[model samples]
Target: MASFTTPDGVTLAYDDIAPAGEAERTVLLLHGFASNRSEGWRRTGWYGAFERRRMRVIGLDQRGHGESAKLYDPADYTREKLAGDALALMDHLGVRRCDLFGYSMGTRTALQAAILAPDRFSNLILGGVGGRLLEPSTDRGSIMADAMLAEDPATITHPFLRSFRQFADEQGEDRRALAAFVQAQNPPLDEAAMAALPMPVLVVAGQRDEGAGDPEDLARVFPLGKGVSLPGCDHFSAIPHGLTKATVFDFLDGLLDDPFEGRF
Candidate 1:
């Protein structure tokens, strides 16, 4: 449990879990929307997995979530700002390079981070998001923002978006801050932009994940990318699955004979 105040006065929270000796490999974890570092990774079994593997873990609570400062203004949640926080945290911790892992909203931020600081990441593992990253940004952010700001959750008409409100409630997160994060516009990027990333990327999503599109489509864009699907899982359920762990570890360990093949 540690904290750092951003240049803008936003206090972000984070935890650096590492081996007793100096760390050889580091993984920076970015959680999905409405999820804090602990719930997204530690309690979800990632911390233990990394511990056993002897990899250092840097888990950050991005602005508007967890113990971090909550700002109500949408202007404060730009993609660059979100990505900057990740970079800034790394700078704060004196981490030169790491394997980056992000989920859902965190994946969007990860893309921004990779684009901005292409050399800081050695490998990227994006979960809970897929081909949807290539799609144009639409009004869904506004709709989701409205859902988070809704006085009554029942009024949110979109079924899937409504579930976000419910999940936020369960997590006891700040709806106003989350609404701002949802409303913040992402940078203009497409498949060509994704194609430009040079690091090894693994895009993993649940087979039944309707929230994200085809993971294979997303993976094929990168020169060194691969995609894998966790059978019979959805966006949230895939997080703690054994298959998810295997796919990620195998990729990180370079154990797969054909790295380009999109499955285990």
Candidate 2:
């Protein structure tokens, strides 16, 4: 468990895993809402894949989740602040640049970071993101936002009851803690902010994402970016595997040569 104090003086946590042989590239993995580093991409063998590619992987836990500093204030969970935390960690670790892989909320933060500091990253892999998340404000969004702030574990867990119970039993994540964490961390980004990001972005999303941001909508955001729709995958199932992993690696390979190229 390593830690860094952000510019805001909040402590952030991260796990650094180095490959056995010579390192090729470094990858920073960011997890989604209500989840930590180990629970999201790390469990999917992404760290191992990076190891196979001789890449050093950094898995970070966002504030208020995992072992990071828990600030219960909702205002502290804004997108700008979240992105700043990543940069602050990078500064602490002496990393000039690195590739980023962010899933769901993590991806949103990654987008903001790339926009806020365009030169901080070599490339980006955004999973489960396609467009502005705060748009089309619905009654459902308000309800979920309130339920999240209220810290109602039952209502939060009802959708993933079986999975949540199994995860708690297996991984020791307190459902109530996660529920409260998720409920309080609802930050929305406006369209202008979303469109300002500059990078060669790769957007990957599940074909069936339960009425979330449409894949096509996300793909259209960056004129030079490419979007890929994962077949036979729901949100969780779209994780890079087999051919999918190869696809991402190929994209990363190209980007490593020319990180600023907007074309996929």
Candidate 3:
């Protein structure tokens, strides 16, 4: 575990998982909304995969979440600020370029970072990147209602939610704070804005993604982009599936060469 200070003076936390030798390249893993670095990748077994593959892993706890500062400024949670934290993490580590993998809310941050820095990332692998955040669709909340209602809402939302709630219960990070963060948050970009990103991109979606349009809508936008579906899975379950795992690894493997040069 390592801690770095952002330009904003927030002491952000990151977990560095690497093999003994020099790192081939770093993959920045960003977690979803209300999730922290450890819960993001550590719990998912993805971090273990990266460690076995000999790749350096930089897992971040986004502002206002996890062990990082929990500011309620709302501005603190914007895509711009989230992406900035990524770059700041890299800068602090002295890494010139690396790949990025963001899931759910983390995916939006990945896209935003690639657009803003353009050159800072070699390739982008976006899992559960549904589409533009600004586009309104009723699908997201409705699909999960049945499942959420059936199960304890927090546990179904994420495995660590129960533990997090317990931590927040003792530490005083209220459920209202989490709810307010979600309500105040909106997708930061539209399709046109996303299309302008020049980096090689991969958009993965769940077959039953309720919040965004179907995978076809997301795939149609980026002809150069590869789209794959996780059969029988929704937004949260998609990434851990066999199909998504194969697709993501294959895509990242292909981008390991010079195309990763700081082009955008």
Alpha-carbon local distance difference test for all models: 0.88, 0.69, 0.68
The regions of model 1 sitting more than 4 angstroms off are 257-264
Report the lDDT tens digits of candidate 2 across residue range 104-220.
868878888887887888887888766545465445433444444444445554463434444444555544444444444444554565465566677777767553456557756
lDDT (tens digit, per residue) of candidate 3 on 96-176: 899898888788788788878878887787777554444664544333323323335555555434443454444444344
Rate residue 261 of model 2 by lDDT. 44
Candidate 1 has its poorest 10 consecutive residues by lDDT at: 255-264
Candidate 1 local lDDT, 73-158, one digit each (tens):
88899988998999999999999899999999899889889988989999999998778878887898888888998999998888
lDDT of 2 at 112: 80
For candidate 2, give the lDDT of residue 89.
81
Q: Least lDDT summed over 10 consecutive residues: which range in candidate 2?
A: 255-264
Model 2 residue 251 CA deviation (Å) reads 1.7
TM-score of every prediction relative to native:
0.94, 0.80, 0.77
Index of the highest-lDDT prediction = 1
lDDT of 1: 0.88
Tell me the TM-score of model 3.
0.77
